[model samples]
Target: MTNRNIKAIKWFINTQLLGKWYNVAYATFKVTSKCNLKCTFCNPAYYSGTLEEGSTERLKKVIDNLRDSSVVVLSFEGGEPTTRPDILDLLGYAHDGSFYVMLTTNGYRLGDPSFLSKISERIDFLHYSIDEYHWNLKALDNLCKFREFGLKVNVQTVVTRYNINTLEDKVKKVRECGYKILLMPAVDYPDSKVKLEPDKEQFYQVLSYLKGKYGSTLNNSWGFIRALKGEFPKRLTSYAITIYPNGDLPYPDDINGEVIGNLSQNKLGELLNSYRAKELRRKMMENSARYEYLHLQTASFNSIKDLAEYAREMGKWAFTGKA
Candidate 1:
Protein backbone atom coordinates (compact mmCIF):
# COMPACT_ATOMS: atom_id res chain seq x y z
CA MET A 1 0.00 0.00 0.00
CA THR A 2 1.08 3.57 -0.60
CA ASN A 3 2.49 5.55 2.31
CA ARG A 4 -0.40 8.00 2.11
CA ASN A 5 -2.91 5.16 2.17
CA ILE A 6 -1.18 3.72 5.21
CA LYS A 7 -1.34 7.07 6.95
CA ALA A 8 -5.01 7.37 6.07
CA ILE A 9 -5.69 3.96 7.58
CA LYS A 10 -3.79 4.90 10.70
CA TRP A 11 -5.72 8.15 10.97
CA PHE A 12 -8.99 6.24 10.76
CA ILE A 13 -7.89 3.85 13.48
CA ASN A 14 -6.66 6.64 15.73
CA THR A 15 -9.70 8.87 15.43
CA GLN A 16 -12.36 6.15 15.39
CA LEU A 17 -11.27 3.19 17.50
CA LEU A 18 -8.79 4.93 19.74
CA GLY A 19 -11.20 7.87 20.12
CA LYS A 20 -8.51 10.48 19.63
CA TRP A 21 -10.84 13.44 19.37
CA TYR A 22 -7.85 15.79 19.19
CA ASN A 23 -6.37 13.98 16.23
CA VAL A 24 -6.34 16.86 13.82
CA ALA A 25 -7.66 15.89 10.39
CA TYR A 26 -6.53 19.14 8.82
CA ALA A 27 -3.58 21.40 9.89
CA THR A 28 -2.79 24.76 8.30
CA PHE A 29 0.63 26.34 8.96
CA LYS A 30 1.48 29.84 8.00
CA VAL A 31 5.04 29.77 6.64
CA THR A 32 5.30 33.49 6.06
CA SER A 33 3.45 36.76 6.64
CA LYS A 34 5.00 38.71 3.80
CA CYS A 35 2.74 39.09 0.79
CA ASN A 36 3.13 40.59 -2.67
CA LEU A 37 -0.32 42.19 -2.59
CA LYS A 38 -2.43 43.81 0.11
CA CYS A 39 -6.03 42.62 0.12
CA THR A 40 -8.91 44.71 1.42
CA PHE A 41 -11.01 41.88 2.84
CA CYS A 42 -7.96 40.30 4.49
CA ASN A 43 -4.86 41.72 6.01
CA PRO A 44 -2.30 38.95 5.61
CA ALA A 45 -0.43 40.36 8.55
CA TYR A 46 -3.58 40.08 10.66
CA TYR A 47 -2.94 36.39 11.22
CA SER A 48 0.81 35.98 10.96
CA GLY A 49 1.90 39.31 12.49
CA THR A 50 4.95 41.16 11.09
CA LEU A 51 6.41 40.43 7.67
CA GLU A 52 9.09 38.10 9.04
CA GLU A 53 8.88 34.41 8.11
CA GLY A 54 9.94 31.10 9.60
CA SER A 55 13.31 29.90 8.39
CA THR A 56 13.92 26.56 6.67
CA GLU A 57 15.41 25.04 9.81
CA ARG A 58 12.62 26.45 11.99
CA LEU A 59 10.01 25.26 9.54
CA LYS A 60 11.59 21.81 9.46
CA LYS A 61 11.26 21.64 13.22
CA VAL A 62 7.63 22.70 12.96
CA ILE A 63 7.01 20.04 10.33
CA ASP A 64 8.67 17.42 12.51
CA ASN A 65 6.47 18.49 15.40
CA LEU A 66 3.37 18.17 13.20
CA ARG A 67 4.51 14.74 11.95
CA ASP A 68 4.53 13.59 15.57
CA SER A 69 0.87 14.66 15.89
CA SER A 70 -2.29 13.12 14.44
CA VAL A 71 -2.31 15.52 11.51
CA VAL A 72 -3.49 13.63 8.41
CA VAL A 73 -3.41 16.56 6.03
CA LEU A 74 -1.04 19.56 6.26
CA SER A 75 -1.62 22.73 4.27
CA PHE A 76 1.08 25.42 4.14
CA GLU A 77 -0.41 28.90 4.11
CA GLY A 78 1.09 32.36 4.32
CA GLY A 79 1.06 35.99 3.80
CA GLU A 80 1.93 33.97 0.70
CA PRO A 81 4.10 30.88 1.14
CA THR A 82 5.56 31.44 -2.32
CA THR A 83 7.32 34.57 -1.04
CA ARG A 84 9.72 32.47 0.99
CA PRO A 85 12.98 31.56 -0.73
CA ASP A 86 13.11 28.12 0.90
CA ILE A 87 9.43 27.18 0.44
CA LEU A 88 10.25 24.50 -2.11
CA ASP A 89 12.70 22.93 0.32
CA LEU A 90 10.08 23.15 3.06
CA LEU A 91 7.44 21.58 0.84
CA GLY A 92 9.87 18.81 -0.11
CA TYR A 93 10.60 18.11 3.53
CA ALA A 94 6.89 17.69 4.36
CA HIS A 95 5.99 15.78 1.17
CA ASP A 96 7.43 12.49 2.44
CA GLY A 97 4.01 10.81 1.98
CA SER A 98 3.12 10.72 5.69
CA PHE A 99 0.40 13.27 5.13
CA TYR A 100 -1.16 15.05 2.20
CA VAL A 101 0.86 18.30 1.89
CA MET A 102 -1.11 21.17 0.35
CA LEU A 103 -0.22 24.81 -0.36
CA THR A 104 -2.49 27.85 -0.38
CA THR A 105 -1.17 30.56 -2.68
CA ASN A 106 -2.17 33.90 -4.08
CA GLY A 107 -0.99 32.63 -7.50
CA TYR A 108 1.36 35.54 -8.16
CA ARG A 109 4.36 33.25 -8.58
CA LEU A 110 2.34 30.68 -10.55
CA GLY A 111 2.64 32.68 -13.77
CA ASP A 112 6.15 31.33 -14.16
CA PRO A 113 6.04 27.89 -15.73
CA SER A 114 9.40 26.82 -14.31
CA PHE A 115 8.37 27.67 -10.74
CA LEU A 116 5.27 25.53 -11.03
CA SER A 117 7.36 22.72 -12.55
CA LYS A 118 9.58 22.67 -9.47
CA ILE A 119 7.00 23.18 -6.68
CA SER A 120 4.28 20.98 -8.21
CA GLU A 121 6.30 17.85 -7.48
CA ARG A 122 6.63 18.68 -3.78
CA ILE A 123 2.99 19.49 -2.91
CA ASP A 124 -0.02 17.23 -3.39
CA PHE A 125 -2.41 20.03 -4.35
CA LEU A 126 -2.61 23.79 -4.74
CA HIS A 127 -5.38 25.97 -3.30
CA TYR A 128 -5.34 29.16 -5.32
CA SER A 129 -7.15 32.19 -3.92
CA ILE A 130 -9.07 33.76 -6.76
CA ASP A 131 -11.54 36.52 -5.97
CA GLU A 132 -12.38 40.10 -6.82
CA TYR A 133 -10.66 41.42 -3.70
CA HIS A 134 -7.21 40.16 -4.66
CA TRP A 135 -7.41 41.84 -8.08
CA ASN A 136 -6.50 38.56 -9.72
CA LEU A 137 -9.58 37.75 -11.71
CA LYS A 138 -7.35 36.54 -14.54
CA ALA A 139 -6.29 33.67 -12.30
CA LEU A 140 -9.35 31.72 -13.41
CA ASP A 141 -7.63 31.13 -16.76
CA ASN A 142 -4.87 29.17 -15.06
CA LEU A 143 -7.11 26.47 -13.57
CA CYS A 144 -6.62 24.13 -16.50
CA LYS A 145 -2.96 25.00 -16.59
CA PHE A 146 -2.59 23.71 -13.04
CA ARG A 147 -4.38 20.47 -14.00
CA GLU A 148 -2.02 20.18 -16.95
CA PHE A 149 0.90 20.35 -14.54
CA GLY A 150 -0.52 17.25 -12.79
CA LEU A 151 -1.32 19.29 -9.71
CA LYS A 152 -4.77 18.93 -8.12
CA VAL A 153 -6.29 22.39 -7.73
CA ASN A 154 -9.03 23.94 -5.64
CA VAL A 155 -10.17 27.55 -5.78
CA GLN A 156 -10.83 29.33 -2.46
CA THR A 157 -13.03 32.36 -2.98
CA VAL A 158 -13.78 34.70 -0.10
CA VAL A 159 -17.37 35.93 -0.23
CA THR A 160 -18.10 39.56 0.57
CA ARG A 161 -20.75 42.20 -0.06
CA TYR A 162 -18.92 43.30 -3.18
CA ASN A 163 -19.06 39.88 -4.82
CA ILE A 164 -22.19 38.32 -3.34
CA ASN A 165 -24.31 39.15 -6.34
CA THR A 166 -21.86 37.53 -8.72
CA LEU A 167 -21.10 34.40 -6.70
CA GLU A 168 -23.60 32.24 -8.56
CA ASP A 169 -21.89 33.20 -11.79
CA LYS A 170 -18.50 32.42 -10.26
CA VAL A 171 -19.77 29.03 -9.16
CA LYS A 172 -20.84 28.36 -12.73
CA LYS A 173 -17.41 29.34 -13.95
CA VAL A 174 -15.68 26.99 -11.53
CA ARG A 175 -17.96 24.13 -12.54
CA GLU A 176 -17.33 24.82 -16.20
CA CYS A 177 -13.59 24.78 -15.58
CA GLY A 178 -13.97 21.43 -13.84
CA TYR A 179 -12.45 22.41 -10.48
CA LYS A 180 -13.86 22.41 -6.98
CA ILE A 181 -14.29 25.66 -5.03
CA LEU A 182 -14.69 26.37 -1.34
CA LEU A 183 -16.59 29.51 -0.47
CA MET A 184 -15.79 31.23 2.83
CA PRO A 185 -17.38 34.40 4.18
CA ALA A 186 -15.26 37.50 4.50
CA VAL A 187 -14.24 37.95 8.13
CA ASP A 188 -14.43 41.59 9.23
CA TYR A 189 -11.60 41.88 11.69
CA PRO A 190 -12.35 43.66 14.96
CA ASP A 191 -10.00 46.50 14.05
CA SER A 192 -10.82 47.01 10.42
CA LYS A 193 -12.58 50.28 9.60
CA VAL A 194 -14.70 48.72 6.88
CA LYS A 195 -16.76 45.64 7.58
CA LEU A 196 -17.04 43.71 4.34
CA GLU A 197 -19.36 40.98 5.60
CA PRO A 198 -22.31 40.44 3.31
CA ASP A 199 -25.78 41.07 4.70
CA LYS A 200 -26.98 38.05 6.69
CA GLU A 201 -29.97 37.42 4.43
CA GLN A 202 -27.85 37.80 1.31
CA PHE A 203 -25.16 35.51 2.70
CA TYR A 204 -27.68 32.81 3.53
CA GLN A 205 -29.33 33.14 0.17
CA VAL A 206 -26.06 32.80 -1.71
CA LEU A 207 -24.89 29.83 0.30
CA SER A 208 -28.27 28.09 -0.05
CA TYR A 209 -28.35 28.73 -3.77
CA LEU A 210 -24.83 27.44 -4.28
CA LYS A 211 -25.41 24.48 -1.99
CA GLY A 212 -28.43 23.48 -4.06
CA LYS A 213 -27.21 24.27 -7.58
CA TYR A 214 -23.55 23.31 -7.26
CA GLY A 215 -23.39 20.80 -4.48
CA SER A 216 -21.03 18.64 -6.46
CA THR A 217 -18.59 21.49 -7.12
CA LEU A 218 -18.74 22.94 -3.60
CA ASN A 219 -16.12 21.76 -1.09
CA ASN A 220 -17.96 22.81 2.10
CA SER A 221 -20.15 20.24 3.82
CA TRP A 222 -23.86 21.01 4.25
CA GLY A 223 -23.36 21.40 7.97
CA PHE A 224 -20.55 23.90 7.45
CA ILE A 225 -22.63 25.90 4.98
CA ARG A 226 -25.47 26.04 7.47
CA ALA A 227 -23.10 27.00 10.25
CA LEU A 228 -21.87 29.89 8.14
CA LYS A 229 -25.44 31.16 8.02
CA GLY A 230 -25.66 31.10 11.85
CA GLU A 231 -27.75 27.94 11.99
CA PHE A 232 -25.79 25.99 14.58
CA PRO A 233 -28.07 23.33 16.08
CA LYS A 234 -25.51 20.65 16.91
CA ARG A 235 -21.83 20.77 17.61
CA LEU A 236 -19.86 20.99 14.40
CA THR A 237 -17.03 18.52 14.32
CA SER A 238 -13.90 20.63 14.00
CA TYR A 239 -10.84 18.65 12.95
CA ALA A 240 -8.82 21.53 11.56
CA ILE A 241 -6.07 23.22 13.57
CA THR A 242 -3.98 26.24 12.68
CA ILE A 243 -0.36 26.82 13.74
CA TYR A 244 0.94 30.34 13.43
CA PRO A 245 4.36 31.18 11.97
CA ASN A 246 5.82 31.53 15.45
CA GLY A 247 4.83 27.95 16.42
CA ASP A 248 1.84 28.99 18.55
CA LEU A 249 -1.34 26.91 18.29
CA PRO A 250 -4.11 29.41 17.60
CA TYR A 251 -7.11 27.14 18.16
CA PRO A 252 -6.67 23.40 18.34
CA ASP A 253 -9.69 21.85 16.62
CA ASP A 254 -10.77 25.39 15.66
CA ILE A 255 -11.94 26.17 19.20
CA ASN A 256 -10.98 29.74 20.08
CA GLY A 257 -8.85 30.12 23.18
CA GLU A 258 -5.38 30.81 24.48
CA VAL A 259 -2.31 29.39 22.78
CA ILE A 260 -2.09 25.76 23.87
CA GLY A 261 1.68 25.38 23.57
CA ASN A 262 4.48 26.24 21.24
CA LEU A 263 5.37 23.18 19.19
CA SER A 264 9.01 24.11 19.46
CA GLN A 265 8.88 23.66 23.22
CA ASN A 266 6.28 20.90 23.64
CA LYS A 267 4.98 17.69 22.10
CA LEU A 268 1.76 17.84 20.08
CA GLY A 269 0.00 15.15 22.11
CA GLU A 270 0.91 16.76 25.40
CA LEU A 271 -0.34 20.13 24.24
CA LEU A 272 -3.53 18.87 22.61
CA ASN A 273 -4.43 17.02 25.80
CA SER A 274 -3.23 19.70 28.17
CA TYR A 275 -5.62 20.81 30.90
CA ARG A 276 -6.37 24.04 29.10
CA ALA A 277 -7.14 22.29 25.85
CA LYS A 278 -9.34 19.75 27.62
CA GLU A 279 -11.24 22.54 29.34
CA LEU A 280 -11.74 24.32 26.03
CA ARG A 281 -12.94 21.12 24.42
CA ARG A 282 -15.23 20.42 27.36
CA LYS A 283 -16.73 23.88 27.14
CA MET A 284 -17.29 23.39 23.43
CA MET A 285 -18.95 20.02 23.99
CA GLU A 286 -21.18 21.37 26.75
CA ASN A 287 -22.27 24.43 24.79
CA SER A 288 -21.84 23.38 21.21
CA ALA A 289 -24.91 25.35 20.26
CA ARG A 290 -22.97 28.61 20.60
CA TYR A 291 -21.02 28.06 17.40
CA GLU A 292 -20.55 31.78 17.02
CA TYR A 293 -17.93 31.77 19.78
CA LEU A 294 -16.27 28.74 18.17
CA HIS A 295 -16.29 30.51 14.82
CA LEU A 296 -14.95 33.87 16.07
CA GLN A 297 -11.71 32.17 16.98
CA THR A 298 -11.46 30.67 13.51
CA ALA A 299 -11.91 34.07 11.89
CA SER A 300 -8.39 35.27 12.77
CA PHE A 301 -8.91 37.49 15.80
CA ASN A 302 -5.41 38.30 17.04
CA SER A 303 -6.23 40.01 20.31
CA ILE A 304 -8.45 39.30 23.30
CA LYS A 305 -9.82 42.81 23.09
CA ASP A 306 -11.28 42.17 19.67
CA LEU A 307 -12.48 38.70 20.55
CA ALA A 308 -14.32 40.09 23.58
CA GLU A 309 -16.00 42.77 21.53
CA TYR A 310 -17.22 40.25 19.00
CA ALA A 311 -18.28 37.91 21.77
CA ARG A 312 -20.49 40.66 23.19
CA GLU A 313 -22.02 41.20 19.78
CA MET A 314 -22.60 37.47 19.38
CA GLY A 315 -24.26 37.37 22.82
CA LYS A 316 -26.48 40.26 21.95
CA TRP A 317 -27.58 38.66 18.71
CA ALA A 318 -28.04 35.22 20.20
CA PHE A 319 -29.99 36.38 23.27
CA THR A 320 -32.02 39.38 22.15
CA GLY A 321 -31.93 38.79 18.37
CA LYS A 322 -30.53 42.29 17.92
CA ALA A 323 -26.98 43.17 16.95
Candidate 2:
Protein backbone atom coordinates (compact mmCIF):
# COMPACT_ATOMS: atom_id res chain seq x y z
CA MET A 1 0.00 0.00 0.00
CA THR A 2 1.18 3.51 -0.73
CA ASN A 3 1.76 6.02 2.07
CA ARG A 4 -1.06 8.12 0.67
CA ASN A 5 -3.66 5.34 1.00
CA ILE A 6 -2.55 4.69 4.57
CA LYS A 7 -3.03 8.31 5.49
CA ALA A 8 -6.32 8.37 3.65
CA ILE A 9 -7.54 5.27 5.49
CA LYS A 10 -6.58 6.64 8.87
CA TRP A 11 -8.31 9.87 7.94
CA PHE A 12 -11.37 7.97 6.76
CA ILE A 13 -11.56 5.99 9.98
CA ASN A 14 -11.27 9.17 12.03
CA THR A 15 -13.91 10.91 9.96
CA GLN A 16 -16.19 7.91 10.29
CA LEU A 17 -15.87 7.69 14.05
CA LEU A 18 -16.06 11.43 14.61
CA GLY A 19 -19.12 11.50 12.39
CA LYS A 20 -20.65 8.24 13.77
CA TRP A 21 -21.01 6.97 10.24
CA TYR A 22 -19.16 3.61 10.22
CA ASN A 23 -20.83 2.65 13.47
CA VAL A 24 -23.99 2.76 11.40
CA ALA A 25 -22.52 3.47 8.00
CA TYR A 26 -23.40 0.34 6.04
CA ALA A 27 -26.58 -1.75 5.88
CA THR A 28 -27.23 -5.07 4.13
CA PHE A 29 -30.56 -5.07 2.32
CA LYS A 30 -31.87 -8.40 1.14
CA VAL A 31 -33.80 -7.71 -2.04
CA THR A 32 -34.77 -11.35 -2.55
CA SER A 33 -33.62 -14.63 -1.07
CA LYS A 34 -34.32 -16.41 -4.31
CA CYS A 35 -30.88 -17.64 -5.40
CA ASN A 36 -30.32 -20.00 -8.29
CA LEU A 37 -27.40 -21.91 -6.78
CA LYS A 38 -27.61 -24.21 -3.75
CA CYS A 39 -24.24 -24.11 -2.01
CA THR A 40 -23.76 -26.47 0.94
CA PHE A 41 -22.85 -23.90 3.57
CA CYS A 42 -25.91 -21.84 2.66
CA ASN A 43 -29.26 -22.01 4.44
CA PRO A 44 -31.81 -22.54 1.68
CA ALA A 45 -34.83 -22.21 3.95
CA TYR A 46 -33.94 -18.54 4.36
CA TYR A 47 -35.33 -17.82 0.90
CA SER A 48 -37.65 -20.49 -0.46
CA GLY A 49 -41.08 -20.65 -2.07
CA THR A 50 -42.76 -17.66 -3.72
CA LEU A 51 -40.45 -14.67 -3.83
CA GLU A 52 -41.35 -11.95 -1.32
CA GLU A 53 -39.92 -8.43 -1.20
CA GLY A 54 -40.74 -4.80 -0.57
CA SER A 55 -42.08 -2.81 -3.48
CA THR A 56 -40.06 0.16 -4.71
CA GLU A 57 -42.37 2.62 -2.97
CA ARG A 58 -42.09 0.73 0.34
CA LEU A 59 -38.31 0.48 0.13
CA LYS A 60 -38.07 4.16 -0.66
CA LYS A 61 -39.96 4.93 2.54
CA VAL A 62 -37.51 2.74 4.44
CA ILE A 63 -34.65 4.73 2.97
CA ASP A 64 -36.38 7.90 4.02
CA ASN A 65 -36.14 6.91 7.69
CA LEU A 66 -32.38 6.55 7.34
CA ARG A 67 -31.99 10.29 6.82
CA ASP A 68 -31.11 10.51 10.50
CA SER A 69 -28.63 7.75 9.78
CA SER A 70 -25.39 8.74 7.97
CA VAL A 71 -25.03 5.29 6.46
CA VAL A 72 -24.61 6.43 2.87
CA VAL A 73 -23.13 3.10 1.76
CA LEU A 74 -25.69 0.41 0.95
CA SER A 75 -24.90 -3.19 0.11
CA PHE A 76 -27.60 -5.00 -1.84
CA GLU A 77 -27.43 -8.78 -1.22
CA GLY A 78 -29.75 -11.68 -1.33
CA GLY A 79 -30.50 -14.90 -2.34
CA GLU A 80 -29.03 -12.73 -5.22
CA PRO A 81 -30.12 -9.11 -5.39
CA THR A 82 -30.22 -9.21 -9.17
CA THR A 83 -33.03 -11.76 -9.14
CA ARG A 84 -35.54 -9.10 -8.19
CA PRO A 85 -37.71 -8.09 -11.16
CA ASP A 86 -37.35 -4.48 -10.02
CA ILE A 87 -33.61 -4.65 -9.45
CA LEU A 88 -32.92 -1.75 -11.79
CA ASP A 89 -35.71 0.30 -10.32
CA LEU A 90 -34.43 -0.36 -6.82
CA LEU A 91 -30.90 0.60 -7.90
CA GLY A 92 -32.30 3.71 -9.51
CA TYR A 93 -34.07 4.60 -6.29
CA ALA A 94 -30.73 4.38 -4.45
CA HIS A 95 -28.95 6.30 -7.22
CA ASP A 96 -29.14 9.74 -5.65
CA GLY A 97 -25.33 9.88 -6.15
CA SER A 98 -24.92 10.45 -2.43
CA PHE A 99 -24.77 6.77 -1.53
CA TYR A 100 -22.25 4.14 -2.53
CA VAL A 101 -24.28 1.25 -3.88
CA MET A 102 -22.61 -2.16 -3.69
CA LEU A 103 -23.98 -5.55 -4.72
CA THR A 104 -22.86 -8.95 -3.39
CA THR A 105 -23.24 -11.27 -6.37
CA ASN A 106 -22.35 -14.88 -7.01
CA GLY A 107 -21.18 -13.95 -10.52
CA TYR A 108 -23.23 -16.60 -12.30
CA ARG A 109 -25.05 -14.01 -14.40
CA LEU A 110 -22.13 -11.58 -14.59
CA GLY A 111 -20.47 -13.95 -17.10
CA ASP A 112 -22.94 -12.56 -19.59
CA PRO A 113 -21.57 -9.24 -20.85
CA SER A 114 -25.09 -7.89 -21.24
CA PHE A 115 -25.72 -8.08 -17.49
CA LEU A 116 -22.77 -5.78 -16.73
CA SER A 117 -23.92 -3.30 -19.34
CA LYS A 118 -27.32 -3.17 -17.71
CA ILE A 119 -26.21 -2.68 -14.08
CA SER A 120 -22.90 -0.88 -14.61
CA GLU A 121 -24.74 2.38 -14.83
CA ARG A 122 -26.15 1.95 -11.33
CA ILE A 123 -23.65 0.22 -9.01
CA ASP A 124 -20.48 1.80 -7.62
CA PHE A 125 -18.88 -1.45 -6.56
CA LEU A 126 -19.56 -5.12 -7.33
CA HIS A 127 -18.71 -7.50 -4.47
CA TYR A 128 -18.36 -11.04 -5.79
CA SER A 129 -18.72 -13.92 -3.32
CA ILE A 130 -16.15 -16.60 -4.11
CA ASP A 131 -15.47 -19.09 -1.35
CA GLU A 132 -15.50 -22.78 -0.44
CA TYR A 133 -19.19 -23.10 0.46
CA HIS A 134 -20.32 -21.00 -2.47
CA TRP A 135 -18.07 -23.18 -4.65
CA ASN A 136 -17.29 -20.43 -7.11
CA LEU A 137 -13.50 -20.24 -7.04
CA LYS A 138 -13.49 -20.03 -10.79
CA ALA A 139 -15.82 -17.05 -10.74
CA LEU A 140 -12.82 -14.75 -10.79
CA ASP A 141 -12.68 -15.18 -14.55
CA ASN A 142 -16.29 -14.05 -14.81
CA LEU A 143 -15.49 -11.15 -12.47
CA CYS A 144 -12.71 -9.94 -14.75
CA LYS A 145 -15.25 -9.63 -17.51
CA PHE A 146 -17.12 -6.88 -15.62
CA ARG A 147 -14.05 -4.67 -15.11
CA GLU A 148 -14.29 -3.66 -18.74
CA PHE A 149 -17.72 -2.24 -17.90
CA GLY A 150 -15.94 -0.07 -15.25
CA LEU A 151 -17.69 -1.70 -12.30
CA LYS A 152 -15.33 -1.57 -9.28
CA VAL A 153 -15.00 -5.30 -8.59
CA ASN A 154 -14.13 -6.63 -5.14
CA VAL A 155 -14.05 -10.32 -4.27
CA GLN A 156 -15.23 -11.46 -0.81
CA THR A 157 -13.60 -14.72 0.26
CA VAL A 158 -14.76 -16.14 3.58
CA VAL A 159 -11.69 -17.98 4.83
CA THR A 160 -12.53 -21.39 6.29
CA ARG A 161 -10.52 -24.43 7.46
CA TYR A 162 -10.85 -26.01 4.06
CA ASN A 163 -9.35 -22.92 2.47
CA ILE A 164 -7.70 -20.75 5.16
CA ASN A 165 -4.25 -22.24 4.69
CA THR A 166 -4.25 -21.25 1.07
CA LEU A 167 -5.75 -17.76 1.54
CA GLU A 168 -2.47 -15.91 1.10
CA ASP A 169 -1.93 -17.55 -2.24
CA LYS A 170 -5.51 -16.78 -3.11
CA VAL A 171 -4.97 -13.13 -2.22
CA LYS A 172 -1.90 -13.08 -4.38
CA LYS A 173 -3.81 -14.74 -7.19
CA VAL A 174 -6.76 -12.36 -6.76
CA ARG A 175 -4.41 -9.37 -6.87
CA GLU A 176 -2.93 -10.77 -10.05
CA CYS A 177 -6.48 -10.88 -11.44
CA GLY A 178 -6.66 -7.07 -10.96
CA TYR A 179 -9.41 -6.79 -8.31
CA LYS A 180 -9.45 -5.81 -4.66
CA ILE A 181 -9.81 -8.74 -2.21
CA LEU A 182 -11.85 -8.42 0.95
CA LEU A 183 -11.16 -11.28 3.32
CA MET A 184 -14.05 -12.35 5.53
CA PRO A 185 -12.78 -14.83 8.08
CA ALA A 186 -15.38 -17.56 8.48
CA VAL A 187 -17.65 -17.44 11.51
CA ASP A 188 -18.90 -20.36 13.57
CA TYR A 189 -22.25 -21.90 12.80
CA PRO A 190 -24.26 -22.10 16.00
CA ASP A 191 -25.66 -25.55 15.19
CA SER A 192 -22.66 -27.05 13.51
CA LYS A 193 -20.60 -29.84 15.09
CA VAL A 194 -17.09 -29.24 13.79
CA LYS A 195 -17.37 -25.50 14.43
CA LEU A 196 -15.87 -24.04 11.30
CA GLU A 197 -14.57 -21.03 13.23
CA PRO A 198 -10.79 -21.09 13.42
CA ASP A 199 -8.88 -20.70 16.67
CA LYS A 200 -8.55 -17.09 17.81
CA GLU A 201 -4.76 -17.10 17.54
CA GLN A 202 -4.85 -18.44 14.03
CA PHE A 203 -7.39 -15.87 12.99
CA TYR A 204 -5.30 -13.04 14.45
CA GLN A 205 -2.14 -14.39 12.92
CA VAL A 206 -3.66 -14.31 9.48
CA LEU A 207 -5.20 -10.89 9.94
CA SER A 208 -2.05 -9.39 11.41
CA TYR A 209 0.04 -10.86 8.64
CA LEU A 210 -2.28 -9.46 6.07
CA LYS A 211 -2.50 -6.04 7.68
CA GLY A 212 1.25 -5.72 7.69
CA LYS A 213 1.73 -7.35 4.31
CA TYR A 214 -1.13 -6.60 1.93
CA GLY A 215 -2.68 -3.77 3.91
CA SER A 216 -3.89 -2.34 0.63
CA THR A 217 -5.95 -5.29 -0.61
CA LEU A 218 -7.74 -5.93 2.69
CA ASN A 219 -10.86 -3.81 2.40
CA ASN A 220 -11.57 -3.82 6.17
CA SER A 221 -10.23 -0.89 8.19
CA TRP A 222 -6.77 -1.08 9.81
CA GLY A 223 -8.08 -0.41 13.27
CA PHE A 224 -10.49 -3.29 12.76
CA ILE A 225 -7.66 -5.45 11.53
CA ARG A 226 -5.49 -4.54 14.51
CA ALA A 227 -8.42 -5.06 16.88
CA LEU A 228 -8.84 -8.60 15.61
CA LYS A 229 -5.13 -9.32 15.59
CA GLY A 230 -4.06 -7.83 18.91
CA GLU A 231 -6.89 -8.82 21.21
CA PHE A 232 -9.49 -10.83 19.29
CA PRO A 233 -12.07 -8.26 20.33
CA LYS A 234 -15.39 -9.89 20.69
CA ARG A 235 -16.81 -9.07 17.30
CA LEU A 236 -20.18 -7.42 17.33
CA THR A 237 -21.87 -9.25 14.47
CA SER A 238 -22.90 -6.32 12.31
CA TYR A 239 -26.26 -4.65 12.87
CA ALA A 240 -28.33 -5.02 9.74
CA ILE A 241 -31.96 -6.11 9.66
CA THR A 242 -31.58 -8.71 6.90
CA ILE A 243 -35.11 -9.44 5.77
CA TYR A 244 -35.63 -12.31 3.40
CA PRO A 245 -37.98 -12.31 0.47
CA ASN A 246 -40.52 -13.35 3.08
CA GLY A 247 -39.56 -10.29 5.08
CA ASP A 248 -38.44 -12.39 8.04
CA LEU A 249 -35.08 -13.17 9.66
CA PRO A 250 -34.27 -15.66 12.38
CA TYR A 251 -34.22 -14.07 15.81
CA PRO A 252 -30.65 -13.32 17.01
CA ASP A 253 -29.51 -13.60 13.39
CA ASP A 254 -26.27 -11.71 14.08
CA ILE A 255 -26.35 -8.63 16.33
CA ASN A 256 -27.59 -7.23 19.66
CA GLY A 257 -30.12 -4.94 17.95
CA GLU A 258 -32.01 -5.95 14.79
CA VAL A 259 -35.51 -6.60 13.59
CA ILE A 260 -37.62 -7.38 10.54
CA GLY A 261 -39.59 -4.17 10.55
CA ASN A 262 -42.79 -3.71 8.61
CA LEU A 263 -42.02 -0.37 7.05
CA SER A 264 -45.61 -0.11 5.92
CA GLN A 265 -46.53 1.26 9.36
CA ASN A 266 -43.69 0.90 11.88
CA LYS A 267 -40.92 3.44 12.19
CA LEU A 268 -37.87 1.44 11.13
CA GLY A 269 -35.54 3.03 13.70
CA GLU A 270 -37.96 2.78 16.60
CA LEU A 271 -38.89 -0.78 15.75
CA LEU A 272 -35.26 -1.87 15.60
CA ASN A 273 -34.03 0.10 18.62
CA SER A 274 -37.19 -0.29 20.69
CA TYR A 275 -35.26 -2.54 23.02
CA ARG A 276 -33.85 -0.49 25.86
CA ALA A 277 -30.18 0.47 25.94
CA LYS A 278 -29.74 -1.80 28.96
CA GLU A 279 -30.38 -4.76 26.70
CA LEU A 280 -27.15 -4.12 24.80
CA ARG A 281 -25.01 -3.10 27.76
CA ARG A 282 -23.73 -6.63 28.21
CA LYS A 283 -22.67 -7.02 24.58
CA MET A 284 -20.93 -3.65 24.72
CA MET A 285 -19.05 -4.74 27.80
CA GLU A 286 -18.05 -7.98 26.14
CA ASN A 287 -16.75 -6.12 23.13
CA SER A 288 -14.69 -3.71 25.22
CA ALA A 289 -13.06 -6.50 27.17
CA ARG A 290 -12.27 -8.42 24.01
CA TYR A 291 -11.10 -5.58 21.75
CA GLU A 292 -10.07 -2.52 23.74
CA TYR A 293 -6.38 -3.30 23.55
CA LEU A 294 -5.91 -2.95 19.80
CA HIS A 295 -6.43 0.77 19.27
CA LEU A 296 -4.38 2.09 22.20
CA GLN A 297 -1.80 3.90 20.13
CA THR A 298 -3.81 5.42 17.31
CA ALA A 299 -4.78 9.09 17.30
CA SER A 300 -8.45 8.19 17.23
CA PHE A 301 -8.16 5.95 20.28
CA ASN A 302 -6.63 8.77 22.27
CA SER A 303 -9.19 11.15 20.81
CA ILE A 304 -11.95 9.06 22.41
CA LYS A 305 -11.38 11.11 25.59
CA ASP A 306 -15.08 11.28 26.27
CA LEU A 307 -15.24 7.47 26.36
CA ALA A 308 -12.36 6.65 28.69
CA GLU A 309 -8.97 7.79 30.05
CA TYR A 310 -6.75 4.70 30.42
CA ALA A 311 -7.62 3.87 26.84
CA ARG A 312 -4.64 6.22 26.33
CA GLU A 313 -1.85 4.31 28.15
CA MET A 314 -2.77 1.24 26.18
CA GLY A 315 0.07 0.42 23.72
CA LYS A 316 1.46 1.07 20.32
CA TRP A 317 -0.36 -0.53 17.44
CA ALA A 318 -3.24 -1.47 19.71
CA PHE A 319 -6.64 -2.13 18.17
CA THR A 320 -8.72 -0.78 21.03
CA GLY A 321 -11.10 1.42 19.10
CA LYS A 322 -11.83 3.38 15.96
CA ALA A 323 -12.25 1.11 12.95
Give the TM-score of each candidate: 0.82, 0.72
What lDDT score is found at residue 41 in candidate 2?
Answer: 51
Residue-level lDDT tens digits of model 1 in 77-134: 8778888889899899999977778899989899899999988899876888999988
What are the clash counts of all predictions, listed in order? 0, 7
| Candidate 1: clashing pairs of residues | none
lDDT of 2 by residue, 122-241 (tens): 887788888877777777544455556876667788766667787787677566645667776555444555556556567667877875676545554444555554533233323233
**Candidate 2 residue-pair clash tally:** 7
